[model samples]
Target: MAQTNNATLIRREIITRLCRLFAEGRLEDIDRIALAMAPRNAQTNGSRCCIHKARAIIKYRIMALLGFNVADETDELESLYSYALRALAGTDRGEGVLTVVGEACTSCVKSNYVVSNLCRGCLASNCMVSCPKNAIVMENGQAKIDSLKCVGCGLCKEACPYHAIIYVPIPCEESCPVKAISQNSEGIEQIDYTKCIHCGRCMMACPFGAIMYKSHLISILHQMMKADKPVVAMLAPAVCGQFRASYGQLVTALGKLGFADIFEVAQGAELTARHEAEELGHVLATGQQFMATSCCPAWVELTEKHLTQLKPFVSETWTPMRYTAGLVRDKYPDAVVVFIGPCVAKQAEALKYPGVDYVMTFEELGSLMIARGIDLQVFEVEEQGAVIPERQFAASSGVLNSVAAYYSGEQIKPLVISGLHKKNMAVLRRLATGKHDWNMIEVMACEGGCLSGPGGVSSPDVARKLFNAQSGVHTEMLVQ
Candidate 1:
C-alpha cells in the first residue's frame, strides 16, 4: 500500500471541517465550505490549475461526503447546501458506495514505459542493447522510444544507466488489482461495479482526489442527536491502534460522541474463531482438501463476483461484525448499531445483514473527534474488561493464530495470503483446483490486514507496535 499523501490530508481536513459545522449547529452554512476553504482570489494549492478548479473539486468531495454521488447529478448548478439538506433529511437519495469526480480526474495518459529527458545517451547504449524489441534508440541527445514497437516490458527501464527510462501509470487503474477500473468514452475514469471487489485501492491511490466513497455520517449523527433510542457503537479490534490513547480512552471518546454504549467486536471474534475451528475440523474429516477463512468481506465478495470456483472452499462461518451486530440486537432490540472499523467492504457487508444499521471508518471517527473537540489525552480511561486472545485479530496472521489456539482435531498446515494483488489472486485460483497440500488458508485483502485498510488512520507498522504493547502477544505466529 502507498503512504499517506497530500490528497488524503485534504480529504481529512474537509471531513473535519464539515463535521465541525454540524457539531456547532451551523449546518445552515454548509454550502459555504468551498468558499471558506478557497476564497475569491485566494492562492490555490499548486496541484490544481486555479482557485476555481480547486473549489469545484472541493465541492464534489463535499457532495460525496453528503451521500450524493457527483456522477448522478444532472444539474451543474446544484448547491452544496441543497445536498446537505437532503442528506440530513434522509430522503430522495440513493446510497452509493463509491463515486468518481470527472472534473478532478487528470485522465492520466495510457500506461507505458517511455524514455525521459534525463536520458544521457550514454556511449555504451545499454537501453538500446537491452530492448528486446529494439524500440529504444539515441536521438536529440536523449534516448527515444518507438511507441509502435514498445511492449512495456520494462527491460530498457532497468538497463538505463541514468534511470531515464520511466513507466508512467494511471494512478487509479494501476492500483486496482482486478482490472475493474477503466476509461470511459470521454477518457474519464469509470468503475465497473460488476468487476470491482470494493477493496478501496482506487480511492486511496488517486493522487488527484477524484474517487470517493459515499458516507453515512449525517444519517448516523441524526440518530444520535434525537436521543430517543440507544445508539451503540460496535468497535473493531483495529481501533486499538488508531488513536494515541488506551482502548478505554477510545471507548470514552465514543461515549462523548453520544454513543449510549460501546461493544468490542473482538468479543465476537473469539466466538467466530471457535466456530470456524470446528467447521475446519469437520471439513477436513469429511475429506475436503482445505478451507478458507470467510472473515474478509472483500475476499468473500471476490469469490462471489470473480472467483466462483473458490466459493465452495470458503468457510460458511459469519464474520465478527455479523456476530457482534447480532449480539447488540439481542441485547438492545431497539438500538441502532453502528459498526466502527478500518474497512470499506464493511459498508457493503452491512447491507447484507439487517442488524448493522451503519458503518463508520476510523478516519471518519477521527474527524468527529476533531469536530467535537474531544481530546483523548485528557479523558480518564474507563476500566476495561480482561483482554482476550482474539484482541490480536487486527494483524494479518492473527486470525490463523486465534484459530490455532482452538483447533485440536488435527495438526494444521497454514497458508496466509497477506494481500490480494493480481499474483496472489492467481494462486487462489490454483488452490481451488484441489492440488494444494495446505489444510487451512487465511486471507486479508489489505497487505498487512485490517490495520492497513484504506479507511485506516495510522500506518500498519505503527498500529501493530501499539497493539503489541498492550496485548504483549506474538501475533504473527502461524500454525505448524
Candidate 2:
C-alpha cells in the first residue's frame, strides 16, 4: 500500500514553499516553482511521480491564494489564471498542476448565510418584539446587532414581518448535520474538525470556494507511472452524468491518460447487489424486520455519529467503489487503484477503508483532462464497452431498482432514501423505531443521489440522460 500520510506531508511541504514564493513577489519564477514541485521524474527519482505531485501542489497553492475563507464570488477566473500562469512554466508545461488550479478557481467558500439586502424598517418591530429578551435593536433605519445579550435563538431573523433580518451562515457550518459550526470572535466558521464527519457537503454549498480537502493525485500517479503498478481506474456511475461528452469518449480519454484499465463502479454495484441481497435474506431469516444498504458512505457516517441507533440496520456489503477496487486488486496483485467519481465522501471513505488508494472526483478529472489539453470531442480514442451501475446507481430509486432486480422471492418492499438533511431525518427516525415496515432501504445523502454530490460535475438531468442511454448494454450476465 502507498504511504498516504507521507504523500500528504510532501503535498503540504510543497504548498508551503509555493506560498512563500508568492509572498516574495517572485511571480516570474512560477516555472521554477512548478519544476521544483513536480512529482519527481520516475526515470531519475526513487518514488516521486511528477505529474501527481504537480497536481497536488497546484491545488493547494490555488486554495491558499483564494484566502480559503468561505464566501461567494470566489469562483472568479483571476484565481485560476494566476495559478495557471505560475504553474505552467518551461519544463512543467501541460502538467497536472492546472487540474489543481482550475478546481480551486471553481470552488466556493461555503458560508453560514447572513441576510443581505432585505430588511424592513417596520413600525410593528415584530423582529424585536418576537425576542423574549431584547437582543435586537433598530438603529439608523436598519437592524443593528448586540451580540453580548442576544442568543443565536434566530427569532429575530425568523420573526421579522418583512423577512428582512437575515442570518449569515458559514458555508461548511451551514452544511453540517449537527450544529457543529459556531462563530469565533472573528466571525470565521470554526470547524470542530473532530466533530466533522468529513462528508464535505460544505465544500459543495460554499459559494466562495474556501473549504479544501487534501489531494494525493500526484502520489497515486507517480506510483502508476514509475512503479508500473497496474493502475486501475474505477469510475463512479455519476460520471456518466457529469461530462457533456459521450461516456465512451470519456473512457477513451482515461485510457490515453495512462490508466491500465477502466472499471465501472456499476460493476461494483452488481457486487453490492449480490451481497446486499444475501444480507437481506439473512436479515429476514433471522427475523430482523428491515436491513439498510451500507454502500453509501455519507449515510453510514451520518448514521454512525448522529443515528447510532440505526447502525444495526445497515447492510454489510462494501460500497460500489470499494468493491471494484477490491476486486481489481485481487485480480492484479500489483494494482494501485484510483477511484474517479463525484463524491468527496469517497475521499474520507478511502482513508477508512483499504483497497482504494486515491479518490478523484469528476470535477478533478475534468480539470486534469483540460490541463492536458485533451479535448473529448476531437480525441481519436478506442471505445471500451459501456459499464453500467447496478446498486444505488444514479439519483432517486436507482439503488432500489438494482436491489429489486437481484431479489426474486418474498415480494420485497424496500424504502428509497435520498437527501440526507433535516427534512429526511424523520424517515430514518421512523425506520429505526418501527414506525415504517419495509424489507430493505437505499439511502443517498444528496437529494438527487451521487450525481448531486459535492464532487459532482454537470447537472442531474444531463447525467441522467447519459446514464439512461448506456443502460441497455448490460443484457449480458453479471461479472463473477
Using lDDT as the measure, the top candidate is: 1
* Prediction-by-prediction clash tally: 0, 33
- CA deviation > 4 Å runs, candidate 2: 1-129, 138-143, 157-171, 379-392, 471-480
TM-score of 1: 0.90
* Candidate 1 clash pair list: none
Candidate 1 per-residue C-alpha lDDT over 246-267 given as tens digits, one digit per residue, 9 for 90 to 100: 8888888999999999999998
Which residue segments of model 1 deviate by more than 4 Å? Answer: 1-3, 92-96, 115-165, 382-385, 471-474, 477-480
Error of 1 at 171 (Å): 2.5
TM-score each candidate. Answer: 0.90, 0.72
Q: How would you encode candidate 2's per-residue C-alpha lDDT over 325-348 as one tens digit per residue?
A: 877887887788898876766766
